[model samples]
Target: MHDLIASPFLNSFVVLRPGRLEGIALPERRFRELAQSHGSGLAVPLWLTDAARSRWGIDVAPRPVSHAVHIRDAPVYGHSRASWEINLGCDLDCEHCYLGEKRFAGLDAEGKQRLLLILRDAGVLWLQITGGEALINPHFAASCRLAHDLGMMVEVLTNGTRLTSPTILESLTTSRPYRVTVSLYGATAETYDSFTRRRGAFRRVTRGLAAGVEAGLPLRLALIVTAQNAHENDRMRGMADELGIPYKEYTHMSPTIYGGAESLASQSPAHLKALERFTGCNAGHTFLHVDPHGRASMCKVGRDEQIDLMAEGVEGLVRLGAIADRLMLRTGGCSGCRLSGLCSVCRPLAKRYQEAKAPLNTYCQHEQKGDSG
Candidate 1:
């Protein structure tokens, strides 16, 4: 634990906008500029954590992405998966929602159309659709249809507030959308609603799943492991088995500096060890985050620093994909970390500290790994 307690670099924590270089202040081509301007070394000034600042005293210029594979639609070839949140505004206020409802950015119909086009053109087959709640969006069916039309395989991740509907079934009635992941926040309303702060949600979600299944939607359950739901895995698993629906679980931990920040960071290791699935994240580069805004990111958790797939288009997105691939290969974040293996989380792992010691985001002390067979 001494290493964990030591001051860590925190650049990845700083957020940035598109053309923003993955939230990094330094543009892709500007690394050498700083080198020529500064005496010898000058790292990008983008970190915001105190411990991080202290670790690397000098800001050494970062290594820019090698312009090796610059082909559009060329598979940088990875274990790649992509997710798109059709909307940010959700009906339920789950404890884990990093933005709560303050940063909702659900896509409009036109936005959805263009987004699906971008994905289809990019050849992004594996996708995850989320929201506020995607089902709540009037564009849900059209969105799914567009993805299906493009011959893309899809996955819909949603809270139970809206799911398993007769209408949803009709939309998913195809070979494209292989699965719909419904969150099992809790087994009972009393337990589920405690964190969601909503009443009658647990029941709605369950019924919704049944409705979807009845309508032929391939429904699966996702149980987010949390402090409150620490010991509920067995019950949830049992329920899934009894219902004959495949179930999966994820141990929760706080890695964001956003909403419910307190609730996220305070999970005890002893408790997390019991519920968490992995200690770190690997969803950003490993997983593509195509948002309702027509912006593409590495993963859902790291929604900042978007690659503008529309303005920049698919070719631009392909360039971003290459950069992301290089960024993931960075030694600054996960090189020496303990959770590097199961830390399959692709969200920005390394951080460029103020002190210049760029370390991986070690917030996830414990990771979740399970045989969700």
Candidate 2:
């Protein structure tokens, strides 16, 4: 019943009660000593009772404590945020879409509401609604309102096409989404159309950004980099500056969730290699991705293992954690590699290469070059 906690993101442990996480930070060494002395049987740093009393205003008392569950041993459910793909439909057809040609009939309005309730009851605080274009869904606004009513923060990930319509704009204003993230394919109509293959989409999306800004809604812009539009990265940043909206750039692209590599040709191997190591994946730990048909997985990249949410509900979600725990890459190649720090490749992607019987040429090449030098 002690209040020490470990942070997956910070790689550091802290002592605090739930919902009041602002507590004293303990050095890893001190924490480990306390944990060992207390026989907590957990790896997290101990509560540092003396330091807690003087520095963090924590009340320290001597009391016999029972066994402590390792933070990693705790169930992922009710602990992390989630990303839900409300629908698979989109107005623009980007060649690099991870979904590829996969399609599914999403839940009805009632079903979506029920799902939202379950997520909220499960202690999921943040719900990111995404899709080929979430705003285009018929029940998009209503779903946002429902999520808001249920005490979950709602973030809408959209292409921005539907936001330009007055009716849609009105609904968005009323629903008051916590935030809206618009994906900008390119900086101009020609470049955007080249990537999206949808004429006039760039104009619609830009207009949508303006409307959202004018409506006083929080908006974030993300430039999706591809071979066709990679050269326009600067222009995309300028566009975001011009609009005075927060923006980010995404350059790495994963093979389609369906295992199609058509878009892989456009990805830059060097750029991919230079990418930061993915430390916290949404998978079984604290995040889940539910596709249109209610099939939930750890994340979009690792959707190979799935559980039917509609069929199993929360039980299905718990099963997903079990599935992710059991997912491990083949050992020989990556098991003990010293280049783990420099290598951005993950188990799921490694498994994909193994299945294809193709060595991860980029990674192997980098390793060879490093060894030679």
Candidate 3:
């Protein structure tokens, strides 16, 4: 594998290392030239060679384009990003998991390969492979390798339980994803294991994290703060700080994907933080999500409408933009709500909250206004 990856990120171009975070931006013209030079046996430009050497300490001199560079071609589709759930299987069961019922099921090998290629053809440059615990998926290594070979910057969303496995570590070290994001439950085993309802999970996760850091893998942490472990919030932050890993905290717990209120029970009533303003998002316009069965949706939360990739293939994504539009409309319980414009949650999320019959204070400003009779 080449030490660096040169690819088109939507309308722009980037030159980045596979396992490291540092990267360089390349002008479109330069990117086109490099891509077109592949078959011509043209040597890589000195500018890139110099940048790689100075920035990443890798030498690419005296090597032709075919050998030195892996330039990914621009896609024919307009979409640029996507996330896929390889499977719903998980080792530990967290109380706040949005996927309430974690079924260990997904597409077979042939179906997975087909779905990945469809993602590439649909112009997904940045892909996130998530799961109940993505690492536990039997096909994870081969599927991850296929995604990289397809020229997509892959990020694995894992639980960190398997990061210490020699086979898993070797696979990741070899192909090297752009990032491996691990979820942080708590600072101590008592809190973590209790929150996940699994014994010895905290030790396994810490060991995995240590192994990952030692291997110089690009790792990020997602601090999941829930009622079960909210007291350790400070300790969790401290752990990330001590590890020198960047982290984002998730304080609010949402309803399950199946519109059940099970996950909301785990919300930390006193610790819930105000969410950032919900400016509009480009869910289906620029990004989409796919379930394990190759079913595509506007995003993770907005799964009301879906496209069956296995049946219609990538061309089916043409309808995703329209689905996004319909899903975002202020209909159903939100219809004519004066606070629609300032609502903290999107329409789809609001719909899920409505379905779950969650407390109004959890998602709406309407609760404060009451019904003005």
Which candidate has the top score in lDDT?
A: 3
TM-score of each: 0.64, 0.73, 0.95
Which tens-of-lDDT digit does each residue in 269-367 have in candidate 3?
798888765888999988999999999999999998999999999899999999999999989988787767667899999899999999988998866
* Full-model lDDT, candidate 3: 0.88
Minimum summed lDDT over a 10-residue window in model 3 is located at 364-373
lDDT of 2 by residue, 25-133 (tens): 6566655555454555333223445655665465544532222211211123543578899998788888878777836468998888877766654445557899978
Residue 330, candidate 3: alpha-carbon lDDT: 88
lDDT of each structure? Answer: 0.55, 0.66, 0.88
What does candidate 1's lDDT look like per residue over 1-373, in tens digits? 0011101012111212111112223332333333343343333334322222354332222422121101112233332357777877777877665544435555668878887776655546456787768877788888887765554556787775665565766666643356677878777778877867788778887787677666656678887777776667678888788778888676645444231344454243444433234444444434577766878776655444678877887666645555565555536434665655554344352232211231223233332332221
- Off-target runs (Cα >4 Å) in candidate 3 are 368-373
Q: Backbone collision count in every prediction?
A: 34, 2, 0
Residue-level lDDT for 203 in candidate 3: 98
Query: Best TM-score goes to which candidate?
Result: 3
